[model samples]
Target: MFTRNGVWAIISKDKIKDFFHRFKSFHIIVFFVIFAVGVLPCFILSRGIVANYESRAIEQRIVNIKTQCEIIINQMGMSEYLDEPSSEVINAQLTQLANFYDGRIMVIDKDYNIVKDTFSMNTGKTIVSEEVINCFKGIENSRYDKVNNYIEQAVCIEHSVTKKIIGVMLISVSTDSIVDSIDILMTKAYILQLALSLAIVVVAFYVSRRLSRPFAKISDDIAEMSEGFLNEEISVKSYREMELIVKSINKMINRMKVLDNSRQEFVSNVSHELKTPITSMKVLADSLLMQEEAPVELYKEFMTDIVEEIDRESKIIEDLLSLVKMDKTSQNLNIMPVNLNELLELILKRLQPIAAKRNIELLFESFRPVTAEIDDVKITLVISNLVENAIKYNVDNGWVHVSLNADHKFFYVTVEDSGIGIPKKSQEYIFERFYRVDKSHSREIGGTGLGLAITRNAVLLHRGTIKVSSEENKGTTFTVRIPLSYIAS
Candidate 1:
């Protein structure tokens, strides 16, 4: 829809709809309003400026005519002569004036009869044309209007000395030259506007696509994720802030994946852990009842087995409670400066008896003394878990090596064993709670599977990093790196 202007303009409905869609409807309306106020006014003002120039040209011509007529009248004093020689003399003066000014001149008697006409007699053309007749009748005063083959026009009055109407002067200037100039200016303006509008549209389209492309990609990624593709990540190439947003989204997806896996593992581990002891108790009870006369020795042995199963179940419950506490951030580490090398010495001394029972050769190797600020109790638990796993998994006379080293920034502790190594596929998930590389072996070795998970959490609390390297039937190495100070310089 358009409002009333001096002149109406046409626009296509599809163009309007497209503009409204590209920009908002409200903005498009405002744009049109501004275009009307700016461009339309300029077009109208240009036309007015052209008209003013024409009017000034016409007015200047009239003034020129009046000045020429005044000079002629001053030279040849006005006198009404009734004789032919006097008339001829006055007519000659009028003829000279007409030739000089490029206009038509006529001599009239007191009764307003044309005695002599200059252009008509000189050029042998009729002076009584419709326009000339109108001028003689005093109806036209050299009216400046458009004429074919003319560039400009003017008309002026030739009055009698007594202030009575004597004759009218008509001067015509060709306007074709000026009209051509104006048409050229109009064409140039149209071309310039077309070029500018095309440039604006191109720039707008480019910027919109550049800004909206990343978001469109992100939208597509989200659609894929919604279809059970949680492994997929949204990738974007943009500025740092845009990258940060994309990073945050991907991190959230990873956390959800971890949580889902944790939940499934938790349920399976809990059911399996509970079922083992319960099934053992049931079997033992059933076997005892099958003997009608149970021996005293057999009864004591069965009771002892039941007590051990109960203890095992209780320990599992306690480990679960500890995991819950760790999950909730309820376990706070009392950190202090502790000599890591000295701490390793204590752990090795305590595990030596268990190593001897398994006939495993235990060794501690330290390149240098390394000190770090850590919680002694938590670190001890981490060491204990690693050593216990080494003892449990090793064959008779297998070797376990514990070592310590330090760099300028971080302290490193490593534990390695010549036991059955973890598979490459399982290394990535070994630290996850209740994840077992070999389910049957894990049961035989009596692992609750929460040990490594808790150890990882403790190391993280100390702002440390842990990594595992292993190959089947070779050896497994666990390395932990911790900063020497809580605040690294």
Candidate 2:
């Protein structure tokens, strides 16, 4: 269904499109810029040279004709040339000068009559134009008409002894020879321009192509990455800019890998945590149903176990909801002034009962009376969570010391616990959602593993910081520094 002409047309259209696309490319843009910068001045200079030559040639021809006309006019003024009007000596000199430059000379008297015309076309003719009248007024003038390609000069003739104006000598010279020379110069200049333009084109093409090769390599590397070859590192170091681009892309790749791992881990942890309570409930229910008319005491015990499992599930879901809420609450905060000392005291008071269960002591100390702008509810959660974790993870009869201090700009809360310490490796990830230091111990302690993550988020929302430092069996200390006035990021 295709003809050769149609196929050729299609190929030509595609080539045109690709050619324009290349013009839009970075290297092609560079090429055209360099080419223009190189060629434009040469073109301007060529035209300038031609124009200058034409001007100077026309001017020199005018000067020579004017000089010869002045001499003849002076000789005639001393003799009886104007009265005679056709002297052989004057006419001969005028005719010869006119023939030399391929021009014409006219002698006009005071009465505006052409007394002598070299060409003999307008001899004895009366002329009354502005130029001849002005020359009789003793004003000498010259004009070059480029459109007519001729130069005309009006020289006022003066008497030799009296220095009074007698007549005007008008000279006209054809510029055909100057024009021909200019045409030849233009032709040569055009040839030179073409040669230089071709050379510049070659240089532009080579330099632009060579300079863009590294970028082309970078583009190919990124394309390969898009095709799922992410494990390979982009390594174009030919240019510093390319090197920086490669480094940035490689850094992004590494970050993506980290986020990918984090996502997979989060999903696995969620599935396991949600399934755990259901499994325990299923086991308890099955055990009860397997009994043939189980006793009331046994049923009550099984129901209590089931209820505990349900509570555990509810707590996990609640913590997951809080973690999800943290991601969206950076822009929304019910900020207000609250007494930090009172808030810490209230947190310790509420957590005292939990500490009492483990025979752990809760101590609160305030270095100064501190008031700060904060979201009371979120700040309460952050403080209570840290203090509660301190209480929960403590050794029997251990102590939790909460101290509050403040300066002109910020308030600091420090919760130190004498409890099981975190390993250096695990400390780095303690704030990550669903990350636990010791799985068995975390489960026994009934942690949803999202407390510290939520705590970190709350602190960050307030434009504050929380840091933990600990050693094995040496306990842990969490220090929170919050600004006196909340500043929105």
Q: Candidate 2: TM-score? A: 0.75
Candidate achieving the largest lDDT: 2
Model 1, 113-227: lDDT tens digits are 4444565653322344555556545555455547553322222234446554444334444445456766776677667666755655555556556666677777788888889
lDDT of 2 by residue, 97-173 (tens): 88987888888888878888888999888888778888888777788888888888888888999888888888888
Q: Model 1 off-target regions past 4 Å?
A: 1-303, 324-333
Which candidate number has the best TM-score? 2
Q: What's the true lDDT of residue 428 in model 1?
A: 91
How does model 2 fare in lDDT?
0.89
In candidate 1, residue 439 scores what lDDT? 84
lDDT of every model, 2 decimals: 0.71, 0.89
The deviation in Å at residue 385 for candidate 2 is 2.4
